[model samples]
Structures are given as structure tokens and as C-alpha cells.
Target: MNRWFAATTAAALTGLSVIASPAAAAQNCGGPDEPAAIRFAFAQLPFEPLTGAKWDPTPVASNYDPCATLSTILVTVEGATGSSPVQALMFHHGEFVGTGTAKAHGFTSLDADASSDDTVVLTYKTPDESTVRYRWHDDRVVMLDPAPSAE
Candidate 1:
């Protein structure tokens, strides 16, 4: 009787509840359901993509905006020195846009030197706008105004 009771108790104690899943974690960093208009602006620092594959791939910023007048850009990278994410507010012709932040994890150049000029790249897509891609250089966020392509 004692052995049977002990086994039952052990089995009950071993039972585990369901916790967060991979799909839930991916939602925070731009999941597939998220809108494409979401934009992310980063500093002039190279960063690796969040791809699960193990290879040198084109690092992409899933959340990026083109028409939105970025006022600030924040960056955060682990295992790197002299390269810090920035929080900048930009004004073009006197207007306001949304805010964003960036982080470079497991990146090669980002891990080596994230502060170098003309290294970081921002990529995003929009419904009305073509795929917007920009590279930071000369201490400036290359602003790309969306224009309708005559097809």
C-alpha cells in the first residue's frame, strides 16, 4: 500500500503545465500576422538577422517604415563593444512619425564593431509602397520617399 501511494504522489508531482510556445515568442519581434507597415530604424551598426538557420545571411529588419518620419532610433546589441543602440527623433519639413528600437544579436560585423559607419541596414515592405531598403552612412538615416512606380 505504501509503495502504491508513493508512486501515485510522484506521478502527480511530475505533471507539468503548458507554458509559452515558440509561436508566442515570435509575435513580439514581428510575426507573420503582423502588418508589413511596421518600421524599425537602427544606428550605423551591422546586425545579423534573426533567422534560425546557421549561415551568413542578409540581416533584415522586419519592422521598417519609409514614409514615416523617424524621430528616434534605438539599438541594442549583445557581445559587442563601442556600438550602442540610439534613440533619435528626426524631423523633415517639420512633422512627426512613430518611434522604434533595434538590436543586433549573433551578428558577425555587429559583434565585431557595431559603431562603424555605413554598416547597418534597414529593410521593410509596405502595401502602397515598394520594398524599402536603406543603409546607414555618413551619420545619416538615408530617407527614402515612396513614389508610385508607373508600370
Candidate 2:
């Protein structure tokens, strides 16, 4: 009687496993936003490419100023020893906004040496017009519209 009971329990467990298999699982990963894609004009360097970079756009409350809100972005990339031309990250927000590169300013250019651990700084006028600048800081890439100057 014990042997028969054990066999019956095993069969029931096997049936449950089959019902809970991945083949019967749902497809969606669990979120509204799709995974972002990263593309570079040049080849990717060592380490890992910037994957979990985040951006936050400030909410526009009342006045209809052209540039009301601001956006903050941040990401980290690997370093390269020798000089190699490199560019990365194509940002798409509602429209194909633009691409940001690690430019060492007056030094060589975006296509000169890879700027590792450099935070790409961008100032957006209205999420449309913007400037992409790179720096050697591992902080947030704060994008803000220039404040009005005193008359």
C-alpha cells in the first residue's frame, strides 16, 4: 500500500512540473519601456559597454516656456590604453534626438582616444536641440536649459 501511495504522489508531481514548464510561461519580461539599444560609430573597447545608464526628465508644471524641464543622464564605459577613435550611444526620446560621444574637447577629437569612465554631459534646449559634451567625472549627466541672464 505504501509503494502504491509513493508512486501516485510521484506521478502527480511530474504532472505539475509539466504544467509549470517554461514553454507554458508568459513572454513579457514585466515593464512598459522597451530595452534601449546602444550603437557606436567605432568598435567597442574592452570591459562592458554602458548598459544601465539612466535619465530623468523634470516635469513641466505651468508656464509654456520653450525649455522648461531638464534631463539627467549617467553611464560608465571601459578604458582603452592606446589612442583609438570611438563614439557611442544613440538616444531616442519620442524622436531620434541625437547621439552622444566621448570627446576630449580641444585635445584630439571624438575619433581620437577612448574616454573611459567619462560622463557625457548634454544640455538640451527642449529635448530637441542639445549639445553633447564628455567629461572625466563618474557622476550624473545633468542636462538643463541655460538660466536667463540679468538685464
Candidate 3:
């Protein structure tokens, strides 16, 4: 009886941890459903018929706090080849808003992070790096600082 009770207790504790892990992780970032956010970003891509395009496994930036009034996430949609232009997608409150104005071309890398609860800073590397800032206003994401044209 003692052996059975100990095993049951251990099993219960393990189950509780498994259940708590996801909640703990969600609180840190990406809200309760990260996959949902990824799917939303993919569907809102400007280029249709995605073809060989795929979303990068990890988000370039995300500040998805459930308790915050606003949250943002940046994801990259990569093309089949390194030289292909990559799209930087933006999401607000888990809803697909739009893509960053900064253009990433020819294997250029892009990264972004939330500087504040309502502001996001994007860094684009086209051999020379440039930064752009966007803010969440009203119900839209607005570019605060425009990036230089890749002319």
C-alpha cells in the first residue's frame, strides 16, 4: 500500500508540472498560442501563392504579454533561396497588421524588438545596417521613423 501511494503521488506531481510548464512559458512570451500567431502571420503575407516560402521557425521579435494593453510580434517569411527577398511580418495583439517597411534583399537579415509596450524597433541588414521604429497607435501600427530607400 505504501509503495502504491508513493508511485501515485509521484505520477500526480509529474502531471502537474507538465501542465504548468506551458502556462509558465506563455506568461514569459508569445501568449497562450504561438502557433496561432505564426499561422496568422503566414496568411497575411503580401505575396500570395506562398509557393516555396516558409516562416522562420523562430520569431525575430515578440513581446506578447497577456496582461499588457498592446503586444507585438515580428516574424520572417523566407524564400527558397538565400538571395530571395525576405518579408518581415508584424502582428499586434496577436492580429496580423502588416509588414515592416524596411526591405531585406539578397540574404539580408532582419531583426526586431519591442522597445516599449507600444513601440517596436526593427534592424535591417543589407550589408549596411539601418534601424526603423514603429509604434502602435489607435488600432494600427505606424512607422515612426522611415528607413532609407534601397536605391
Give the lDDT ranking, best first: 3, 1, 2
Q: What's the lDDT for all of these models? A: 0.30, 0.29, 0.58
Model 3: per-residue lDDT, tens digit, 45-121?
A: 54423344566646555665443434555544553444455555555654556766644443334332346666666
lDDT string, candidate 1, 1-151, tens digits: 9999999887766542212443333343333221212122222223434532222212222222222222223233443343323222222211213222232222111111222222223322223433322334344556343422322
Model 3 CA lDDT for position 20: 75
Q: Which stretches of candidate 1 lie over 4 Å from their true place?
A: 16-75, 79-83, 86-151
C-alpha-based local distance difference test score of model 1: 0.30
TM-score for all models, in order of appearance: 0.20, 0.19, 0.58
* Model 2 lDDT, full chain set: 0.29
Clashes of each: 15, 0, 0
Tens-digit lDDT track of model 2 for 1-151: 9999999999999989876654332122221121221222112323333432222122111111111121112223333322222233322221112334333111112221222223334332323444445432233232233421211
Alpha-carbon deviation at 44 in model 2, angstroms: 15
Minimum summed lDDT over a 10-residue window in model 3 is located at: 104-113
On lDDT, the stronger of 1 and 3 is: 3
